[model samples]
Target: MNAFLKFMKRNYKIVALVVLLAGALFGFTMIPGQKENDPDKDKLLIELLTYVIEKGHYNPAAIDDTFSKGVYKDYLENIDPSKRFFTQADINEFSKYETQLDDQINNRDLSFFYLTYGRLQQRIKEANSFYKDILAKPFDFKADESFNTDYEKMPFAKDDAELRDRWRKQLKLSVLSSVADKEKMQDAPAEDKLKDKEKGFSDEKALEAKPGADVNKTKANGEKKSFTELEKEARESTLKSLNDYFDFVGDLKQEEWFSIYMNAIAERFDPHTYYFAPDDKDKFDTSMRGSLEGIGARLQKKNDFVEISELIPGGPAWRGKELEQGDLIMKVAQGKDQPVDISGMRLDDVVKKIKGPKGTEVRLTVKKVDGSVKTIAITREVVEIEETYAKSSIVKKGGKTYGVIYLPKFYIDFENQDNRDAAKDVAAEVDHLKAQGVDGIVMDLRDNGGGSLKTVVDIAGLFIEKGPVVQVRSRAEDGKPSDKPEVLTDNDPKVHYDGPLVVLINNFSASASEIFAAAIQDYNRGLILGSKQSYGKGTVQNIIDLNRFVRGSTFGNLGALKTTTQKFYRINGGSTQREGVKSDIIMPDKYSYIEIGERDSDNALPWDKIAQAPYKPFKNNFAPAIANSKKRIAESAEFKLMDENAKFLSERKDDNNYSLNIDKFKADAAKIEVAAKKFKALGKYNSNLTFDALPYEKEKFKNDPALAEKKKDWYESLGKDAYVNEALNVLDDLQPKGGKTASTEAKKETRIKTR
Candidate 1:
């Protein structure tokens, strides 16, 4: 049976949505009971349901049914807000289940509820059994033969069961080691050793080699201590270290175990999504808001050590030039001069040491890439979103300059009193580019995950005169439906730019990016070009404060729930959910192995259509312009090399298994190395520089060459990066000239069809 259905069947009674209206009518308005059926639950649930139905994976027809069932299933499986601190009697009450919960749910029988309650009781009984098992076991290392350095790596103990056994043995060994250490310390004759040292017998070698004192060969009671005996002592020392680690973990309480379980479940959803306890919510919110007062760098714990991953451009670290990606941070000091070594420390504890109030200084001692050590001081400050804002550069091609704006992400500072948003930044860029007499502008939204919905609509409005950008449909309580496009809300009548424009996107472009691209395509305002499609995350989420759902309490529930709320659609009637915006000119990308864009995600909103908003097309007679652009792109040597690299990667991905023979691996590695060398040569030519020979250092070449080749191919692939060349060619075609209109019109049509 499906996991969700099975859970629902067992706990239908407890999991059932008790209508808030019903609870209010019953006059159950006291603490726990009143809070359990508060109006906020219904409101939040409805809002989330509506959003999921409109923007979630299921078709509109299946959305309502799926969401209603799914939500109930979720509640049934995990809604035991009270920590399971049940008595022995509760465990006994839950042990009599005969049938699986699914059968009961499907049959709508009361037996299902009883069985579910019984199951919970049975789990508590199992917990008690586990406790007794631990208590009854002998806390001695000798009986547990698994106490060795290689215990964790042994093949016999591969699974969780074996690992647990190993942990138990290690714990016992740790206790024995501690006892031995105390015994050795107590027996130490401090006065005798001090007297011997004063008498010129201090050196361990000199004392052992004393005349008629062959200590190495001597044995107590005529028995020799062999080499094997010495080896055993060394092994015991290593095992003692392992035991110490296990002892610490084994001491956690049952409540901590439950918390760990909850955290693990949240991690299973996605890397970005997390389930935060009430205490962690504030920190989570602060991080997401991007206003944290700390040295602006993202770090990750790798191999039990923290390493810098990305430096937010213009942030403290970036400005100071003290930290770089791949640098290992060994220690962190907050205000105090004494530095604390963070090696092998928990990531949370390290973060606490680094993060502090604005204007406070933090010192980091990092190991640089060149084997040099450096101590750097950084002052924590509020990270400004403007530091990551969209900026444009003018690229001159064939004497014609074109504007290229790089938008990293659609960021919005919602908490700021003056919201200087992405849309505004982009508009300002467009104005700047237009004033420079640029022939055209290229809006690069590659790798942009998206941000505010309001910002997207505003950005889309800048290009189009005035029209609806997208449509949103939300679930209604009475099983009704509502839909409307998000139209341009820019009150200012002044236009930013009225020139040719092109949008560059890839698989990483999503949500707000999709909205903007779809709008431009619908209006035929400019060309959309890049990889196959964009990420199709079209649903919006509203954060519901659980405090509102708790009745008759000032503190209320301490957790907030983020629920899906609405689905966004393009004004042209098509939903950009599963069917993300498809570019006019497709490019090749290395991430083809990765299932990206909307349709790839499970449980994502499906594509649908609604009534199209009326809008006039931005007619441009630039057919010959595109054909001319394509011809240039096809002939570029840089593009050809990139295509070869992409083909190699695609071929590599298709091969399921690699040859196990060492010789075969080496040969393959060599061929890859040569290909990479060729790709680098191509880059050198593009920049008009002397190409250096391949760096064949064993460590560097082993993996670097393969990675370099992949990058080279990604850029060269036709559908992947034709935009850059196309943009350059497009600029050339748009140059004002005394040319024949008829020929230009024909060329434009041909290019459009081909693209």
Candidate 2:
């Protein structure tokens, strides 16, 4: 359900409150010495996780030999991403449990965990030793060799020499980018240097010191180091990286590994049925809380390093104006303390260090978007994740102003119904835009992974004089009162600002977003645009706190499991599961050709349909809007370039094997870089769209420079959005003759703002 991407925006809070409410009503005092860390909790956890999966999951697969083998396969791939850790002999030995994990779980045995953990320890030790040995010798950058970054193409090494060669080639590739960057830095002007000289010490010295090498050596001529020396530094960097990997691995406990094993088992059922450890559960809750007392940045792990994916608008990080997407977090420090190198740290562990009580300050050594590094300080505060809520602005085109509501998620506070929600926020924004005499409205739901189901129903009702919006089908179960498919209708006869409407969606729009989009499309209430389809995630999940199931025991903190409980269906008798909501006008984007969404997921629910909900479709459906958009989109050069870029990226992704030869590598990279230059013109493709913050936002922006900058960036991006530009064309075409509510047989076209 795009759960990974929507963690902070939606899902989390809904899940947490559901459990928190359940716990508060049912929980008893914990037994003395029986807290989550109790020794007996491991077996208890397995008992709980297994019970939940079997009893509560919508469709739990049999934990037979096939399932056990699947778990074994997933474990190997994730634990050793490169497939270099274990040999054929080791695999053969471990294959004994390939079909026994199911039985082991049933018996409450930790033998499999014990065996794998022990063997993995030996492998990591041996692999680190091999990496060190490989680093001891100089690598020939010009050597005619190649490595496959795609691990699926690789098998376990045949023997030790083959394993060492595998390690050697991979390590060489690891340092290639660093070496290239260093080369670029050396030739570039000193004024273009990314980092200041000696914030602490040189990288090479740190690497050598880790391996007991003295760092007192001086350059013989005190001249600039040659390419050869630079390559040496790159290789050393790779070694230090490997050392960090091993160091991080050394701290892995049995419980953590077992949780990974459990997750592997759960993932076999579905992608989103995750098993969170206690610490991870805590983090999940914090994310669901929405605003945390921290720097307020969304971070993601990119390979071995953590990179800032986004900054919560109006947060300390955004206000500080230092962090940006793609910036690598090199180190983290508190106050004047020595900064801890977090280059290879766990994402959650690193998060714990950065986030703190409100008012505390944390300093980050950030590698900026331009490869420049700087030390910046941010005072942690209660950072409101405003972007996760509904926000709107006005866009002017063709001498007419249109409303654009960017609803990031279908957010709602289940614990507190009175809390602000997407439905209410959007309703207010729509009224505001209507008051401004907007000719048309564009609702941007791109990257919206969805949130509250109740919010979806409410938001959907705003478009049409409402009937059924979505259908929910629940599998018949023991003790369940209803097993039939049910249609949820919006009883409120309200159509707020029903002027020409447009919805923008992409591969990331899923779950509740899909429901909303499907309803709008099904009802013919709006013109849908963007990618060929929205992310198909029609299933629903329920988070179960395992602690509740094991009452009267001291083994609390059994964590929780989110299981698929039901499937959502559209009112038009179609399932938005694997086959997502099709756009009225299929536009091309970078993700158009990517294998994402429910179809990419293993064991995702199949697309099926129940009886269509009876509802009236729009008579003046603005079917012409689709044709108009398609015409304009076909003529858009930026869209054509985007399709070409998608093709290039698809071909590039399939070409996984890469040359190790320096000359060949550079040639290939340059070829791709040059081809990428074609996309630079994308930003210049203006829609001639002028935007203004709503009156309320306009007033706030006067006192909030950061707010002004955020809106400014958003406005400029809209101008460059060829898809949105086409949507604007669609909007213009669909608007009524006098810029009133779009003409329909209902003749309901009044200066309507139905509440």
Candidate 3:
């Protein structure tokens, strides 16, 4: 869900144009005290969103019947994908507005949204009662029954009776599966259970147990219960899960649902354009800022109570030392104000109540682990999310130390330029690795769904001399590409780590990640190793604050819109929109045989080419290293198993029919177990490499035990990674034998003039 964002401050022309369009298109009465759910507010949102997209979007879709139909289908599927809530009668009634939505949107009509929303609420209420009634009695496992999970191909129920039957079958299938798991654990011998534990298998009974579940009825007590007892316990767990799900759904406000309808209209143009409500806008800002002012504690809903899941280290809650992880929060109060009961309240609403500005106090009434009720007060402060920043580890392989820097995203705090960013953090990491006397480095970008464009340019500049990083072209008023593409370059000539280098990527690496990889590949600065290709997202979006367009209104925050403003291409002139950036050394992964990139989206833009920018390729020849990695991959048994697993999953993608009959279901499951046994060793494969934290981080562990534990788990996971091991092997091959590395003697290339 990440995107490449270009700050509006850096693009003045686009901002000016958007402001002019807003001034010309909007002229409405400003209601100073309008209610939040007023229809006029929804109309204003629709009008404002459409105008922005039409004026700022790179290639806006025509709002005609075809566009309306796409929105209609997407909106329906998004609301109820399983076809459980809505019957055929409901669909038939909603079909009248399928082609009228485009006209309605132009007129700022809310008729269709109201009709569908009202019907869905009624169906949800009916379905809730149906589940409770169905779970009240025991299911007939002896009877032959089956459930097909291919909801897309299934037809809607014709009447209320058929809908109830559908609900019954779904619940029966769920209970049957849980019962089968319980039966397996009870039937297994003690030695077999220990063997399973050694293989990293979890305790199925413990995992399936919900909060406040009966201890005597579950496998946790090591009791061998009858089939009837296990079935009853499974049913109880399912009921609790459903109740919790409905509770969360029941808390969603009307404005939140309206945001979905707004996005349905925006996404027809492209997949990246989206509409963010006020709360969602705040969340997006917090994510980009990597810090928030609040009592830093993770909470989870347990039945009707909220439990403290974790206390973020170095935050106010953790520093208090009075609150524990298992404490159940019963009431919350602001300073000396009266406590408000939070029972059955939504988790997000509880979080909103607990979080406050820095130096503010919030008191919590919590039930302690020992059943003692106590009131505790904590002062809020800024809590930085440590996981958002870049981290590195050093490992010694074949007598050479190599540093692996993992960048989760190209993050930057847009509101404050002085805050830490990906470019600054990455440069610091390079300096740390050099101080550690490492022979080579690996820039791990797998699953990094991009961020700022400026950070990518700066990060790419770490290895190469001054040159073009990427080329971007905007759509003009005539719906044609700009005459000349703007070439973004890194002007610095100094190389941070000029020695042997490798950049690792996978199917989830996108946007700015692709830009960095493409720059490295184009300059021949490093070998791109991992999946066949990265995620094919080449579009750039800018967040437009919607409040700026409104003159004077008490509608509160109008939120913001993220619209696609331009498309980016690689310096080689080829668009990475659909093709992404191909790896120099292709690696086998679990998703290798599946379609999961931007190309999988039907609304994605088409791939094209532009004039290539002039730049010099490094003299370093990676052919020998690439050839060696290919040879190793061909002979490795672990990779071969992964490839086989990928093919097995691809073949089973459409096999959604599941048997509800106990005997038949067990037989079907045994066949799958036998087939999946070959891939079990892939999980246990270990590289046997030793990865350690740098000296500075290790020193901090003396006072921070949580940080120590987190890094310990990270190092353990890295030691088991086969992909990281192979990347180290490639870096070993790239090491200079009798002279300096290839990049040391490379000459800089001159920048090409714009057309």
RMSD of each: 16.3, 7.1, 8.8
Tens digit of per-residue lDDT, candidate 3, span 199-287:
22221111111121221333557668899998888788778767766776687778877877888898888887888777667764553
* Prediction 3 TM-score vs. true: 0.80
Q: Which stretches of candidate 1 lie over 4 Å from their true place?
A: 1-276, 289-385, 411-419, 479-493, 553-556, 621-726, 734-755
Question: Relative to the unseen true structure, what is the C-alpha lDDT of residue 612 in candidate 2, on a scale of 0 to 100?
Answer: 84
Sliding window of 10 residues with minimal summed lDDT for model 3 = 203-212
Worst 10 residues of 1 by lDDT: 205-214
* Best model per lDDT: 3
How would you order the candidates by lDDT, starting with the best? Answer: 3, 2, 1
lDDT of every model, 2 decimals: 0.50, 0.70, 0.78
Higher TM-score: candidate 2 or 3? 2
Per-residue accuracy of model 2 over 47-108 as CA lDDT, tens digit each: 66776666566667788888888888887776665677888777888889999988987888
The digit string of per-residue lDDT tens for model 1 on 90-165 reads 3244333222322322233334343444444444444334433442433533341423332112233334354345
- Candidate 3 residue spans exceeding 4 A from truth: 1-12, 31-37, 188-222, 244-254, 283-387, 413-419, 435-437, 475-481, 554-556, 693-712, 745-755
* Candidate 2 positional error at 129, Å: 2.4
Q: Estimated TM-score per prediction?
A: 0.55, 0.82, 0.80
